[model samples]
Target: MMASVYDIWGAGFETTVATLQFAIIYLLNYPEVQRKLHEEMDGVIGREQELTMDDQKRLPYLCATIQEVQRASNVAPINFVRTTTEDIVVAGYLLRKGMNVIPQMPSLHLDDKLFPDPERFDPKRHLDKQGNFVKSDYVMPFSLGKRACMGESLARMELFLFLGTMVQKCEFQSVDKDAPPKIAVTP
Candidate 1:
């Protein structure tokens, strides 16, 4: 019981922190994106209002920015290993039953075909023409399916609340005003 609790706590803490760091880095690198986030948050959430999960649906740009951060950051690049219950063929490769398989999440998240200019941090990719947030199956920062991260819901709520409140309260900028450091996504 203690082990399970520790795993949940540690996993949630580490991944969320890493993602938050990437978000700050991206915001500093893309002032325009940060500006748009601020605009949307101010318009929908307002300065005096406390952010909530319900507010997440109303903040399209903020949602898109968070989605984009998860995609671009590739915080959890590889999913946990799974064993095939039965023989199957994937992409023409035959696999016997009980075979161990791991899903490479970064490939899907950063695929040029799925996300054009994948290297660039653009939240518009997750936005529709009408400016609504569009969720993508390919952006699986917490993995997917039945075996997906157990702490997904908690982590998401934490991220939305934490990030939303932070942006609403603070303005982030690079220390070196003239030149910001280039953004890099490492696996």
Candidate 2:
């Protein structure tokens, strides 16, 4: 009944690394966010104490920034397939029973109504006017509903801890100083 240990770690590690690489690249481009994170770390954990999992909730902006990273990463563009239990009409087309439905996770992200300036990377959008993490109905890196990633909660916790620990301890400078901006290519 259990997935192989290799498969579990493989799925978890590869996606986690890719997400972190994107986060590092974004933080490099936005130094202010990095600076703010550093300040928050210093304020909460102080220069002497090592950060712990307990520190995750105390770091509000850091959490928001991480969520934004997950949001903007767009790693899993297309969602998993599911069969409809009953007939339904969608966009003037009839979907019969047992028909396969694959929602576009990336397309929902690109919707301007949900994410303004869909091209720009902004973490503030994840936070409400009161500077708290406002829940978004969108953001489906692991897809959504019943077929959503089984490791969703574990992934979120690990990401927050990893990012908070790394940024708090060391500095990262991009080696590709003159690399051209990447162009979007849909598959």
Candidate 3:
């Protein structure tokens, strides 16, 4: 437990900051969506009340926006590369032994099939027919399968709690009034 504590401190902070940055960027870009989230929060938690972990379930739009942010951010642009131990068939393509494998997280997140109009920053994309929060399988921001990040649950819950509360309390705006903040793209 103490082993990666040092590593986790820096890496964890980096992730949390990046997630919040993206959330702020998206909210600034789309005022309508921001207003919708604000309205939803006001309705559920009320403007004068503070948000708590229990409020996450009640904040569907806020939760959806956070998910969309993570989906769009894909912060860990380059995932750990693993080599194939033996030849395997993937997506109808045959892989050779010892071949390097790179998980294209951003590409998958932006896939039009799993997520319709993937390029658009729409929280409704994560909403169900009943307008409830619906997690997307396409969001592999923390990688996927057996090789996924170990702190996925903690990180996700932290982001949701932090961002949900922040958005509920204050109005976020970029420093530049005229120029729109750029969407962070990691190549």
Candidate 4:
């Protein structure tokens, strides 16, 4: 039982941390996005009390921002390769039963066809014209199907609560005013 707990925490909690770091990076890069986040947090999860998952409904922009962070962050760039249990045809390609299926989840998140202008870190993409959070089916940050990340819901909840609460009280800014914040690429 303890091992299971440790394993889940190591995998799940670490990814949440990564997502939060990415959120901070993006927030620093885009002050306008940070300002909007502050506005939403102020309106919904004010300084009076701590934010809970229940407040998520009232914070559509916060939710959309988190979704955008997850989409752009691409924490788990590649998913655990799963083998086909039986012969299957996907995208007009047939795969043998025992063939290993390597799913590159980032492909979906960064796909221009699914998400228009996939390069931009605009949370508005996750929101509808009416300003409501329109959860996109293509936002497969946690991936899709049976072998998807087990801690997806937990990660989302933690991101929303922790990021929401942090952004509510504090204002983040970049050190250099003139130059944009740089995102380092690493394996």
Output the number of the TM-score-best candidate: 1
Considering TM-score, where higher is better, how would the candidates rank from best to worst? 1, 4, 3, 2
lDDT of the candidates, in the order given:
0.91, 0.78, 0.84, 0.85
- Clashing pairs in model 3, backbone N/Cα/C closer than 3 A: none
lDDT of candidate 2 at residue 151, scale 0 to 100: 82
**Number of the predicted model whose lDDT against the real structure is largest:** 1
What tens digits encode model 1's per-residue C-alpha lDDT throughout 1-187?
Answer: 9999999999999999999989999999999999998999888889989998999889988889999999999898877998888999998999999999998888888899999999899999999999999998889998877899999999989989999999999999899978886777775
lDDT of 4 by residue, 25-70 (tens): 9888888999999988877667877888888888899999999988
Better of 2 and 3 by TM-score: 3
TM-score (C-alpha) between model 2 and the true structure: 0.86
TM-score of 1: 0.96
Q: In candidate 1, where is summed lDDT lowest over 10 consecutive residues?
A: 178-187
What overall lDDT, based on C-alpha atoms, would model 4 receive against the true structure?
Answer: 0.85
Query: Which of the two, 1 or 2, has more lDDT?
Result: 1
Candidate 1: residue 97 lDDT (0-100): 100
True-structure RMSD, every candidate: 1.1, 2.5, 1.9, 1.6
In terms of lDDT, model 1 sits at: 0.91
If ranked by lDDT, best first, what sequence of candidates would result? 1, 4, 3, 2
lDDT of 2 by residue, 1-187 (tens): 2667777777878878888877887788777788888888888887668777688667878887887777777777777798988999988999999999997877877778889987677778887787777657787778887878888788887888788888888776657755623534242
Q: Which lDDT tens digits does candidate 3 get at residues 1-187?
A: 7768877777777888898988888888988888998899888988778677788788888889988988887888778898888999999999999999988888788778888887789999888899899988888778876868877788888897788778778898778867769786673
Against the hidden reference, what TM-scores do the models get? Answer: 0.96, 0.86, 0.90, 0.94
